[model samples]
Target: MKVGLFIPCFVNELYPHVAMATLELLEGYGVDVAYPMEQSCCGQPLANNGDSSGACDAALRFTGVFKDFDYVVAPSGSCVSHVTHHYPWYIADNADFQRLQPRVFEIVEFLQDVLKVDKLPKPVHFPHKVSIHQSCHGLRELHHASPSELMIPYQSRLERILQLVDGIEIGQPERRDECCGFGGTFSVDEADVSVAMGRDRVAQHEATGAEYIVGADPSCLMHMGGIIRHNGRAIRPLHVVEILTGRGGAA
Candidate 1:
């Protein structure tokens, strides 16, 4: 299948390795993935800030860049959710463009749903207890919670894939689907509330006695990881894709 890689602005600039790991994982699964260098932000930052016009321009640019791909996949769930959900709302007039929204899949969802590999290319070992933080966009917006009804508010394809990895024990947080306080602009605008929420989330993870925290979206991990580091805690954060790519390590 022909797939286009959509690297969010933050992933391209700040978390390039996450994107790289995603590409490596897809290619290892014998999938044909292409990176459109012209692709930039998914226009989520603008849209979340209530600037729909600016977001529309960015959305048009994004749509123009990957319109021909069979599927658009991204490592960051929030970015994928933004393009798939928000873009159409911003550009409702373009019927053809709106159709492409459903074609976009977060990396984990694509791997589990499209690839459906019975066995992973390699074994991953993380001999430590780990807690997972579910990002709001991937959880609520993208309906990442639909797979499992176990008390956890969001159940993602990534969590299912992680179960296949060897020696990794996935634990749960206090509030399964609570926000990690990394709502893009929400963090900057409401600094105190953001930190408070993050601190609370980290505390719950700590209570789990887990060595690290993991999640599908890097933005939430980035925020909570920073708080964990600031407090000099031993627990670290990692992306779920990083684990699936067989690159599991502390933070």
Candidate 2:
């Protein structure tokens, strides 16, 4: 299958290693993965900021760039959720949008549900105490992990994926699936509220005694990471793909 890698704009610019780790993880599975140079932002920020015209243009551009692939996989849950859930409103009459809607997936969900990866192809080891931070989009929209509010039996694709790695002990935070206060434009619109929420989330992760805060979404990590760095906290942020490929390092 031809899988197109949809790297989010922030991740592409700020955390290139996360993109590299994602590519490495997919390629490790022997899947045919391609990064389309024509790919750009999925129009989430524009849509969030009430720029409907610009967002619609970006939506069309996204479908045009990635519609040919059998599957469009992104490491970011927010972007995938936007493409899957919101793009229809932007490109309701576009055939490509309809065709590609069900084809896009966040990387963790892609591996667990679509790829059905029970274990890694090779023995991957990451001897670290890590905690899972479920992004709001990944938790609520994509259902990557069971939300605490749902009151259902707890389950996390992120934790399950981490279990596949040798010597990796998964720790649950006090609020296991809480948001890291990085709701794209939400962070910018409410800077004080965002940082306050981020500090609380980071403190919970630190309470787990985890050395790394591993999450599927880089946006959440980036938000909490700033809090950790600003406070001189020992816990570091990591992307799930990095742990899967044994590449988590100061990300």
Model 2 residue runs over 4 Å out of place are none
* Clash pairs, model 1 backbone: 145-155
Model 1 over residues 1-251: C-alpha lDDT tens digits? 79999888887887888889989888888889999998878888899888999999988998889888889999888988888877878886776677677789998888877887766777777677878777788877777765234554544555677788888888888877788888898998998999999999999988998887888888898899789889998888888778877776833
Candidate 1: lDDT of 119? 64
The estimated TM-scores of all candidates read 0.93, 0.97
Give the root-mean-square deviation of each candidate in angstroms. 2.2, 1.2
Which 10 successive residues of model 2 have the least lDDT summed? 242-251
Clashes of 2: 0
lDDT of 2: 0.89
Model 1 worst lDDT window (10 residues) = 146-155
